[model samples]
Target: MRSSTIRRALAAASTVSMLALSVSACSEDTANDSTVDFGYIGDYNGVSLLAIAKKLGLWKEVGLTAKVKAFNDGPIQVQALRAGNLDFGYIGPGAMWLPASGKAKVVAVNTLAYADRVIAQPGITSMKDLKGKKVGVPEGTSGDMALNLALEKAGMTAKDVQKVPMAPATIVSAFSSGRIDGAGIWYPLIDTIKAKVPDLEEVASTRETDSSFPTAFVAGNKVKPELTSKVIKVLQKANDWRARHPREAITESARMLELDESKVKADAANVETLPTADLVAKTKDGTVDKWLNVLGDFFVRNGQLESAPDPSSYYTGDLYTKAYAK
Candidate 1:
């Protein structure tokens, strides 16, 4: 009787252990299905729309629980995505070549033009006058790329000018101390500099030069493919909200960026937000393709990218199609 009772207890313990393992497996699967992480490049003019989306609950409206993280620059953002630290974020079009050559994928073009501006000190009049003068640029950035492109267009190169690598934060000081003759930067910083420097002149704008250069929304190649559509929905909703509420968007963005409202408004006027879903249609119809191809080839010739990437590899239309179609 004693032996039989011990056998029964051991059998019951084994059964309970198996049941616990099954439950643990199910729990693990459920947890894996629920979370997503997203990353965005650090402060820039284009980030305002994304800020409005977060403030207005657009991400929640689209049923995405995103962990929005910020990085110092687009190149860093690309590195994060490559390391599986991000689900999606905005990146410079020129920087996209790094990931396109590897495992990352670009889902859509967020901004279709370079909207940055070159602001110079009072006495600096034109691009010609900029020669031999010190210029400040955020190294390895879109602003840097634009400045380089502008120089090339003027029959000059980086070697012709003294290019000073400075952070956007240090630009004002660099200019004030006569360390740099001009600064190439985007909004908030541009507006801030203008307000601080009474004698600043608007030399050239990125929008004025490369109107077709593509800024993008990129995702990790390993993310669940189905989530791509959801990501588009979030971006489109944010963009639409920005369009409808420009003032509010500006105010909110200004608040987040800690800039003057008028300055924010002035900068906002120069930006044109492109719909993420429209990128593919625009490309297939020869609009985006032509523009991106031109910019790509330009960059290649200027030594930005090793070669012009295949247009299809640089953009994915299916996600946009599904998001808009829904």
Candidate 2:
């Protein structure tokens, strides 16, 4: 009787062990099929892959759902990221300082040669003409950096101009009503500004001075690598779709952002988003590292940082490789 009782207890223990293992497997699978929150600027001015991914339902197709948030600028996005309110954000090179200052990590490259322009009134045809004028700029942005470079090249400084702090969207109305003499902004808003001011002149732009600017997908240090890798995979798919269907991409972006399709097209013309292969290659080949270093050096010179941080400390191409290999 005693031997039979002992056998029954052992059998029951084995059964419970098997049941727990099955439940653990199911939970692991469920974790793999979860939602991710993403953030980006609320305009068509930069690499808007998050919008494309949201429009195409690519995140769902990849076994993940995206909760997308649109921010007015990079600084707001940076705050959300640091507070753990976001799982990922697509930030422009202007805000690359986030990573350099140890606030975030760049996991993948979004676009190359992402440039901004300085638009002035008809008579303000040169950078020197910006002196003593009320110039609207989204400070601490790529446009602001571009304006600085142009000013430096022209032997001028931000002090030379009366800096009017404003966003690109606001720049439109202020500039149109003559509240501001000039604006340092990105496209398709550049075209929109021109429409409002018919004689707006392109005084300077990154197309000539700062061509190495590249936007990136950044995440907080605590975010899981697997999540970023999955996001990059979705981005790769969205980028390919955009490259293959340029007109549709523009229309969809405009519709999503609630902007005019014509303006979106004009903005698209000024930007070059890298194809998947090239993007993957660049990340793997240390090109992204070089670009981030250039961005860091710019901030240092602008008095934002004492020195540039080593790229490896804040950037990693491993995620790109892992996602692509999958």
Candidate 3:
């Protein structure tokens, strides 16, 4: 990730940034169609194939000149996708509503291996203690999901607290200054904040429910349609390289987030990167289908979507099949 991009890792979530997937001329093929405008969340967990593909020069060899942008939040990325300013995106549950709402599609997915953790201020020791306190979370992101889960585990909900909306990168500042009492976020960013305040301690992690939160690489419904298959091929090649060179993959991902190697390595172990064929099989056999249903139901119950569409319709394995053709 670019240092400038990493610097804003915690920008607050924006309510103004709707998915806005209205048909626009922006998702059209550009003059230089070989270039793919890929925007991804800079969170290290989502860095798996994109950063490695760049480091290995895999995308270029696969006939793509990627124009990468790192956004601090996913909804904003959807905003760009809506305007046709982006071709491909790696988004998390925070923005999965796009695909679930027929605005985009999931071309690939990442394992729920990397779950989120909660860091509490010294005075607040456990999830139960967060009642009525001000807590920071970027709304709709995985961190928020984890926070909600943890709160429920403690017999509370969003209604029980003053939910301060802010990016994980910015949470530490507020926390130390006493603006917020705790923060729920992903690994490195959570760790980054902890480094600044050693007295703060970890209280809860969403490991028990990690399997329910798979990360997805989504494409706008009308994205550079022709290159979608090519993009998936390169992603597969990158993941193959990662399995063969686990340490190197971890190191490369760490470099992108500018985080400690061990932190990335620890998180990497939890995230199971699935192969294309298996993901395709799962997608078709209702394994992936069931997961999407659960997610859509959760989002709707939580008031994110009005009605859930057929989750299976949002993905297709045809590209994966053709990508491996003889």
Candidate 4:
């Protein structure tokens, strides 16, 4: 296989990775007086909320300790949450299906207006250009969602192109070495690919078809609403701090997540972190619900789901309101 810095990092890591702050415990059901088992994506696509929460001591301020674990992607994180291995998880677009499919409950929106894009070589300027080309994307991810939607918009489908299912990190070397004609992935690594393939061009993005692509925090069906509320509260505090100290937030997140600070900064460039107050307002005004519906439809049409479930069944916007109200 082709190799690069990111490829090496991802290959060296596993789905059940532990965060730097994670405490090794024998039992998965370790929720107790103060500690909660939390999971977040170990990839760069993940927002730094959990990392920030740990770095700024917001967890202690909120009177809780998080036993954080890192997973390779949203789907794996959701799997852990569903199996009761996690009290909570930070997830991407998979939130649309996980909750509706009776796997988890989305408690709050973490980041909004973020994107997963299809980046291609110079010659592949449009989605249609990829009709017979090999496209690399970690299947069952937000990136896969974007690629399918973009293909549909261009009057094509996944069958029209060769789909190479690889982890996000591997896409770097795959695209750079011309092993794949294009890649559907998110940033930080997108920037990394650009540096390797100077003529790299983003042909499609989630923002094109969906107004907003939001990442969220999820909990199992049995998790108490109170605990989720407290977690969201701490996340809100960290989001507030992150907005005020953007550079420091990136550096601190890099330190906490064991990623390069420069790459983290580049990846965060287009990510828009909404305040808890704003998320509550959006939920009240039905904007968030609409986003969820759009996301659900995307999955259904992509054949990932039998049908789209009602937004209310999965999204609990009241949780955001309640958390921010505190």
lDDT of each: 0.60, 0.69, 0.67, 0.72
lDDT string, candidate 4, 77-175, tens digits? 778887888988877774457776778888877777455788998888998888889999877777777788788888898999999998776777789
Q: Which residue ranges in model 3 land beyond 4 Å of their true spot? A: 1-32, 257-260
lDDT per residue (tens digit) for residues 1-326 in model 1: 00000001111101111100001111223344234566554333445656766676665554555565545446656677778767776666546555546557777666654556667889887777888888897665666766766787788888877888875556755776666898766554555565568778877767666356677777887777667876677677777677677788777766654556675566556556665446647856877667667666766766757887766775666666667778
What count of clashes does model 1 give? Answer: 0
List where candidate 4 sits over 4 angstroms from the true fold: 1-15, 20-33, 43-47
Which candidate has the top score in TM-score?
A: 4
Tens-digit lDDT track of model 3 for 109-146: 75554457777889778887887888898776777777
* Of 1 and 4, the candidate ranking higher by TM-score: 4
Candidate order (TM-score): 4, 2, 3, 1
Best by lDDT: 4
Clashing pairs for model 2 are: none
- Model 4 is weakest, by summed lDDT over 10 consecutive residues, at 1-10
